[model samples]
Target chain A: MTFNRRNFLGVAIAGTAALSAPRVLGQAKPHVVIVGGGAGGATAARYIAKDSDGAIDVTLIEPTRKYYTCFFSNLYIGGFRDFASIGHTYGGLASDYGVNVVHDWVIGVDRDAMTVTTAAGHSFGYDRLIVAPGIDFVEGSVPGWSTAAQNKMPHSWKAGSQTQLLKAQIEAMPEGGTYCMVAPPNPFRCPPGPYERVSMVAHVLKASNPTAKILIVDPKEKFSKQALFEEGWNKHYAGMIERVGPDFGGANVSVNPDAMEVDIDGTVEKVDVCNVIPAQKAGHIAHAMGLTNDSGFCPIDPATMQSQVDENIHVLGDATIAGDMPKSGFSANSQAKVAAMAVRGALTDSRVFPAKYSNTCWSLIDTEDGIKVGASYQATDEKIAKVDGFISQTGEDAALRKATFEESLGWYAGITADMFG
Target chain B: MRERVFFALALALGGAGEGAADGHAEAIGDAERGAEIWVYCSGCHQIGPDAEIGIGPPLTGIFGRRAASVEGFPYSKSMSRMGSDGLTWTLTTLDAYIENPLVLVSGTRMSFEGLEDPTERADLLAFLREYSDKPSNIPEAAPTARPDYPKLSEETLALVGDEAYGEYLSSECTTCHQRDGSDQGIPSITLWPEKDFVVAMHAYKQKLRPHPVMQMMASRLSDEEIAALAAYFGSLSN
Candidate 1:
């Protein structure tokens, strides 16, 4: 649809709008640059570009040549699905949405000049900038956790090399070898994610090496779907999965990477394989550019997704402090659409409408069994809070579990379509 | 005669589509448009046909069924507790309930600010009537008997700090409570009969509410703030 002159001018007069029609159309469509093409930024680019058509020039700068999702990475570890199934290409974005996909890491953003500088030394000027650069692992939190040691002890938090490395470690372990996992603190990437990862890994251990044991050194006593997880663990895995919470001597205070051992409650235990998902914060570039606050996350208006720090910049997905919503692909996808709508509203110079976001997390316990927790969020004056929510009741209904599996796949497809296609 | 027949045929061609009689005219409802209307109800009830029930039981078949007829959906202890509460839901009863359920049946679980506009209420009632089972003839039950509860004495009111200041502080509670009293899982605070509302607020302040989220919220407010919150919620129509 062609931009109507009257509607464009009316929106511009609103002053809060992101793109003034004359200014947007007068020169070039105001460049809306997005950093990171994983879930959030890529989706934003696809949506804003498509909605604006030729009215907004959208550029997506992501370091990765190809994108691999963390959603079904657990299935790969369990040997249920291959790595190929979860991996995706940005071709759909470039070809279908006409998004300018640039394979480069953004180093910094000059808020004053509104230019984003990349590691490759290319500076793209933008009328509006969106950053959704996921999370960075805090290596030094566990005494021995570092990049060098990550090869032997993988975090597998970001899903590509780390996932493969951890899977290989699990395969190489002897029949009776120990598989230890360290779950991070709350407000991390995904709340129920670590538990799901552990559950999936345990499934592999039970199938290949029944005698092998899985240990979780957890920081929190209560976990998401604790009752359902315990029931499944007992019924399916049986003697395979063993958990150690804060009550037990399982609190991982430190680790010795070289020795391949973790120190818990002054006890040093050596393990055959270790998957440490460490504490995380907004990606480093946002920090370097002074976009993050003391909380290590950027604060933004839930309605507009525009940073409170700098109005010119909008942060979506895992990078921003979106309240009550966890960092998941689904959450990111939902937030991206809201942010894109806001950007569109701003460009046209109109009042941006309020947004409601929905997040659903599905955890696969067995080949066919899965559990889900979901909530729909609304933007309040101060924060985003749950307007409606649900947890899977305790049961082993095959129909529900199967439906959840199919819905999870559909969710991924729909979200991907909303972003790139 | 030929020209007149041709003219009649031309007029018929232009406007004849409206005159065709159909038996299933009412059965074929506008589900697409109905989906948009579903937004108004979604605050309390999940509109999904298969969606698991939330706070106010599922409305999958509220259309033509008797009011509060969903089995397994635990009716309010107030309604069930009232004993022999013969409230058969009809279009008129539903319209009245939408305007103000508390006014219609004082102790009912529904605490919604009834739809004020007559036409809108009728449309919503028609929408509900479209899905209900058999229409039944029954008179709306008399008002629920109010349980005896103690009111705040003058001394207690004195203890609650300044009254004027409390009224000013009640604005924040509206973040969750819209004027129409739509909510999911959360009780519509507006419809609370004053005494129960006051007691509940005091209980929350005293750390009686099971939830830490509510307890934390309650602990922060002062005695004056509590009174103001109570007054604001009491003023709201559920």
Candidate 2:
């Protein structure tokens, strides 16, 4: 019960025999325990398992039977794609790569012991633990948007259930009904995501209920893909979508769901349906385990994703305070691979390579065309720096639009394959 | 009907058991192991025993299939353009693309983290061969966050909510080039559109925007952590 440092390798090594485990696990192999089955966790599992070649033991702890990716959730809402398109399973990690998959939410972490305690009350010790469980909403950031209230005014930031609820509200609203969206200030997951959501929703509204309108209460004046998104909105939706930036009383200060109203600055406005994406921190487990500081996120050694306070534990994905980078699925997957490699190197006392990661995001402007942005990165002696990247340019080139849309699909296939495949 | 017949003839000549033997080197993927790998592919790809269109183009017979050749699927114009330009999907080409899709085809629509293991790629290719003769089946799983790990943690988080800290952060960033977006070597984070800055940073943190250094910087902030930093710097007059 008292997870000690010595127990780290022992615990990781013990869980190696669940499924498609390789026949030869070298004695010198390192041990890794990964928490979260999303992009980061799954990628780490695959690379570490494949690269280590049976030398490392990987145990992944995740609660969901299936994961619904937030990347293309906007597309689903836009009716460009369906929900099933972005959903994934962990069978590949279990069967192909020989990872031990546990279906349980992590409840706590015993950092000193290098052990992770799950909600099932089972504790798994690891020589190196990588945590990439994504973000958790910060309660009271918006006055009335509690976890309970979130059900009423779904944040849907986590995808799945919330996505359905938001969709349902949009569907049920009358032709002229008003839909209010509370956009988080900044540094949240998927920076361009909410705008994309609105774009998709507006597309749907225009067709199904022509007079329906969207009111975005943004704390900031601009957003990702601004010109391109505006171009699409103006050209397509016309007058259906209106955005209120900080300059226009969009910096909302409070929410009163009982009245179905959100107060921006000091003004309160009632709406028919509300979608409030509250401010967030690292997931509950990271916070509860003390991996996080007052800011409600974890701090780790950037090069290794190893917790600064606890080196044996690696905090990754949206949970860590990596500067400049956004919290996204692609970044999480890249980090997972790096962390897995680092864990393997550390366990076996092999040389750990310096890290490099890449990301690309495609925003669907319409059913036919899409916009994109991406960059590559490397670690220097002092910090992480971008090497190369690009964003889809403004204006519609039929070839570029079609190319972007197709590239989006390829990217979805490629990443999901990398993670789960 | 004509397409199906041609496909059948191609499968016969390609040799389903041994793979395409017309000097177009096929990958040496383990079909058995590849079958297991297919589970992950099913999440986003249309991969069953046979060819069936799913979230992505069916990978029923990808080994010898032309690049982006699924029928009825809206091919990215970049891809169709490539096809129009006479680009074909040979085994080697497929291998290169699988290693890194973006790099292999810059304008291609399939943005994926490439398969790192050589053997696994070969095996998956072999397994895909089995579907060449059967109906195509690919499962559609939604995509998740892309992977990116941070390269620094303590220093960056300490800079959160502090504009004065930009001097310190800029010290680390300036080594590559000037701080303004006008820098020549690396694109400048300074002077970027506020939304672009926030979203780009978010992408870096989530590992969707992959790089060693950016992942490192992005990994160190919380929501308030990022917002505070974004606000602090975004408010600065470039």
Q: Over the true interface residues, superposed, what is the Cα RMSD of model 1?
A: 13.9
Candidate 1 positional error at A330, Å: 0.9
Off by over 4 Å in 2: A1-29, A349-351, B1-79, B82-238
Q: Candidate 1 residues B125-209, lDDT tens each?
A: 4344333333122222222221111223455444433333333333223222333444332333556655455545544445332
Tell me, per candidate, how large a share of the native contacts it keeps. Answer: 0.00, 0.00
- The interface root-mean-square deviations, each candidate in sequence, come to 13.9, 13.9
**Candidate 1 at residue A363, lDDT?**
85
Q: What lDDT score is found at residue B227 in candidate 1?
A: 66
Off by over 4 Å in 1: A1-26, A349-351, B1-238
The DockQ value obtained for model 2 is 0.02
Candidate 2 residue lDDT tens string, A1-421? 0224345556545554332334233335455788888877887887778767788788999899889988888888778877788788898889988999999988776655556777777877566778887999888887777988876788989989788788888888886998888998677888889888888888888889989889998887888889989988888889988888988777756777778887888888878788898888998878776788877778766677777677778888889876556678877876776677677666664445557666666788777677877776666544445666667667756655775676567567666776776
Task: For candidate 2, give the lDDT of residue A411.
Answer: 61
